[model samples]
Target: MLLELQQIIVHPGQQMLLKDISWQQLENILEEMGERRAARISYSNGWLEIMVPLAEHEKDKEIVGDLVKILLAILDVDFEPFGSTTLKNERMRQAVEPDTSFYIQNQGAVIGKNRIDLNIDPPPDLAIEIDITSRTRFDNYAILGIPELWRYQKQGLEIFLLQDGQYVKSPFSPNFPNIPIVELVNEYVPQCLTIGRSQAMRNFRSWMQENLQ
Candidate 1:
């Protein structure tokens, strides 16, 4: 078999950008790339960004994702977690694979489903990105109309809520309006690095319990 020129190598903590990529071309690339790939993607208009996450990026993604899950579980909210699932809309000319995503308010919409078609199905309620590599781009998520987005970078978290068609930085997540999510990220995520993940999670749960009570 001959080698395909389509192969490209993206290093961790780095990103590659391509221009004038058509929607059909993007679809073909996605199909060829398969779903289990480690690289995350963000496409808007005719621009595509391919980002390869570093190991630290994955660690941060997992920890932040765990934090979100814990928050939902403690709040007794029904949610479905979609980790790095490709979300594409041909009409909108946008495709995004977030580090982690959740269907909270729209959890029932995707219950017991293996595949998600963004054209027919509702988008995830909240999407989280761990930008340890600082290579994440938000245009696609905003265009895809994800209601809430949490961006964690360098041990800090920022919540962006979709009010109209754009994302607005907000201190509180609509899903967890009463909790101090930013502070939670600043506090426990670092604790995870120091005390280890399991202990950090335990402390976070206890802290939430004390605060929420």
Candidate 2:
């Protein structure tokens, strides 16, 4: 049975904490929460947390996600985006749904697979988390061994890379090692909100073609 379930209201949304939950229980919760895109659920070491993402949180998520995709396309890189897909490792007792995830170098590994088993399959190459309402637990992702993580909070983007079994603050993304990760996100994300996504993407593509050449 689920234990120590409590709800905390945070002005715009709610977060529920459940303690002493088993890995099986966390899997059950995910099954029950299927297709509920707004819910952010994380479980680690017998603890479970559920959060309803705030509107502003989603706005930043979209902006960042779009910017990343634009970068991949303009650079002619192969990638598969899995937006907010639940990633779980039963043996590790850890699970999380990133705001946006991508299979970059390992895209072919997950192709045509209906279900991913972390035991064998490689985890997403990059994961994006937007922290506006509630902060994500970086420790959990570290345990999951996701190669790179991008976190957007307080109008600033932070990049972290997995190194020596831990996440270290990174100045450049492993995905785009030569480019400026935080600067690109900061400049284009807000511009998308101002000029509309379509126009912003078009302009960005044109600029990238010229600059990247």
* Candidate that would win on lDDT: 1
Error of 2 at 113 (Å): 2.6
**Model 1 lDDT, residue 23, Cα:** 89
- lDDT (tens digit, per residue) of candidate 2 on 159-200: 999998888998898799788878877777778779987887
Q: In candidate 1, what are the lDDT values of residues 33-112, reduced to their tens digit?
A: 78887787788999988888899889988998999888888888899998888888888888888899999889898999
| Model 2 TM-score on a 0 to 1 scale | 0.91
Give the range where candidate 2 is weakest over 10 consecutive residues by summed lDDT: 2-11
- TM-scores for the candidates: 0.92, 0.91
Clashes of 2: 0
- Residue-level error in angstroms, candidate 1, position 193: 0.9
List the lowest-lDDT window of 10 residues for candidate 1.
1-10
- Give all candidates' CA lDDT scores: 0.85, 0.83
True lDDT of residue 51, candidate 2: 86
